[model samples]
Target: MSAEASVAAANFVTAARSFVGVPWRHLGRARTGLDCIGLVLLAAREAGVDLPDPAPYAREPQGTRLLEGILGHARRVAEAAPGDVLLFRLGLYGGHVGIASVHPAWGVPACLHAYAPRRQVVEQPMDDELRAALLGVFRLPALET
Candidate 1:
């Protein structure tokens, strides 16, 4: 990463970590509750990146729609670094999104997201299953030089 990108990643990761315990809620965009995209949106704002709301989405948006939303604001990338957006396939229900980060406990690559199943925001290691599901990696334009 470039020096500017590294600084932006650090700021973004710090903002994302602040939402670790927020409860999950459909279309939520606040500290009390947030969905995956909401978590990304708010964290970007806190990191000084102003992202427009990507709303009018279902609780389980189709894969194409999710990809479209991501593409609208970010460019697909080959590798994931901290602060990059990670897209994953969630079976037939479509997809999921998260902020890439280093796991606090394991000190390995992890994802910070508002997981519906977990019913809260969490930072979990990107284990094999998650790696298998990963569809793409993306980075916000503002975070790059």
Candidate 2:
């Protein structure tokens, strides 16, 4: 990454980490509560990227066309960097989303997401199994600036 990109990534990580304890709330956006996509939305806004709200979506992945909606707002990238949106195929359809963040303990890239099962936002390593399930890595257009 270029020096500017590196700095942007650092800024994104800082902003995203501040949301660690937010409880998961479907279709919500705010520090009080957030969903996986809400986490991404917050992080991107913090990074100075304004993205349009995706159209109304469902709780399930089967027909929401989540990935397709994201593609309209961001460009898919070959590799993930801090602040990139990571889309995961948790099932047959486009399933989950998260914000990429660097893991402090391992000094490697991890993902920050609002996990519904856990009922709160958490960060976890993007291990092999997780990587294989990734549908795409997308970067906001403003990140190029």
Candidate 3:
């Protein structure tokens, strides 16, 4: 990564970690509550990366629509680095999103996201299940060389 990209990644990771423990709220974008998209939006904003807020979306949005929205703003990447956005195929819907990060305890790749089932923001190891579901990895324009 370029020096600027490295700094942006570090800042993005830090911003994402700050959202841990925040409650989950569909289409939420505030500290009190946030959804996966909201978490990404807020973190990118805090990292000085400009990302459009594609809000007013359905809780279970179509995969194509979600992918199109992301593709319009970010570029697809072969591998996910800290601060990259991960798009996951959650069963039939496939609209989940998260910020890639390093697991603090395991020192392995993990993801920070606003999980609806867990009802809060969490950092979980990127295990096999998540890897299998991964549809794409994306890097914001600001993080590009």
Please tell me which predicted candidate would have the highest lDDT against the true structure. Answer: 3
Model 3 error, position 94 (Å):
3.0
Q: Per model, state how many residue pairs clash.
A: 0, 0, 0
Q: Order of candidates by lDDT, top first?
A: 3, 1, 2
Superposed Cα deviation of residue 47, candidate 3 (Å): 0.8
lDDT per residue for candidate 3 within 1-145, as digits (tens), equals: 8998989898999999999999999999999999998999899889887677777788887655755655577888899999899988866866889999999899999999999989999999999988998988988888876
Predicted structure 1: clash tally: 0
- Return the TM-score for candidate 1, rounded to 2 decimals: 0.92
What candidate 3 gets wrong by more than 4 Å, as runs, is none
Residue-level lDDT tens digits of model 1 in 21-53: 999999898998999889988998999988777
lDDT of all predictions, in order shown?
Answer: 0.87, 0.79, 0.88
TM-score of candidate 3 against the unseen true structure: 0.93
Residues 3-50, candidate 2, lDDT per residue (tens digit)? 787777677777778888899998879998988877777776787766
Which 10 residues in a row give candidate 2 its minimum summed lDDT? 63-72
TM of each candidate vs. truth: 0.92, 0.87, 0.93
- Residue pairs that clash (backbone atoms under 3 angstroms), model 1: none
Structure candidate 2, residue pairs in collision:
none
Error of 2 at 75 (Å): 2.5
Two-way lDDT contest, 2 vs 3, winner: 3
Best by TM-score: 3
